[model samples]
Target: MAKKVVATLKKEGGSAMFTKVVKMTKSGGNGSYAFEERIVSKDSAKDFFSK
Candidate 1:
């Protein structure tokens, strides 16, 4: 699954169309940070990390 995603993102124009976003978030119960990931449109990448 990871390989497929990486291959697809390498295609011409593919990167501009999509992106993989990862955000670090704190756990309310443990005070530990967890990583959150999502495949989102490139245009919305900033919005995804802002939250």
Candidate 2:
């Protein structure tokens, strides 16, 4: 399976920031995907995607 990392944005204390990790891709592949809005943390999200 291809691996993918997604980071979601959220409004916290009147500031916009990454607040959660949406999903982690198991395998790596070049593909496109469409997603809605969600709060994803930056640290956890880095492993799946990029720094």
Candidate 3:
């Protein structure tokens, strides 16, 4: 399954410089979740959103 976007990290100028993605999984009959982060360089927010 595709990871769900949970939040975004930004620079001082209100630019999106990074992103946070999350996923949920089951382990040992219990529920758990994980997080992943990606870097979106300056002037690359558009490229990241276009995906």
Scored by lDDT, model 3 comes in at 0.46
Highest lDDT against the true fold, candidate: 1
- Order the candidates by TM-score, highest first — what do you get? 1, 3, 2
All candidates: CA RMSD (Å): 2.7, 11.8, 11.4
lDDT to native, each model: 0.87, 0.43, 0.46
* Model 2 ranges off by over 4 Å: 1-39
- Can you give the TM-score per candidate against the true fold? 0.61, 0.22, 0.26
lDDT of 1 by residue, 1-51 (tens): 999977888799887798778898899998999999999998899999787
Candidate 3 local Cα displacement, residue 45, angstroms: 1.2
Clashes of each: 0, 10, 0
**Alpha-carbon deviation at 25 in model 1, angstroms:** 0.5
Candidate 3 lDDT by residue in tens digits, 1-51: 122232222235444554333333446555665443465565665665565
Q: What is the per-residue lDDT of model 2 for residues 1-51, given as tens digits with 9 covering 90 to 100?
A: 122232221234322445544553444365655443355655555654452
Point out the higher-scoring one by TM-score: 2 or 3. Answer: 3
What does candidate 2 score on TM? 0.22
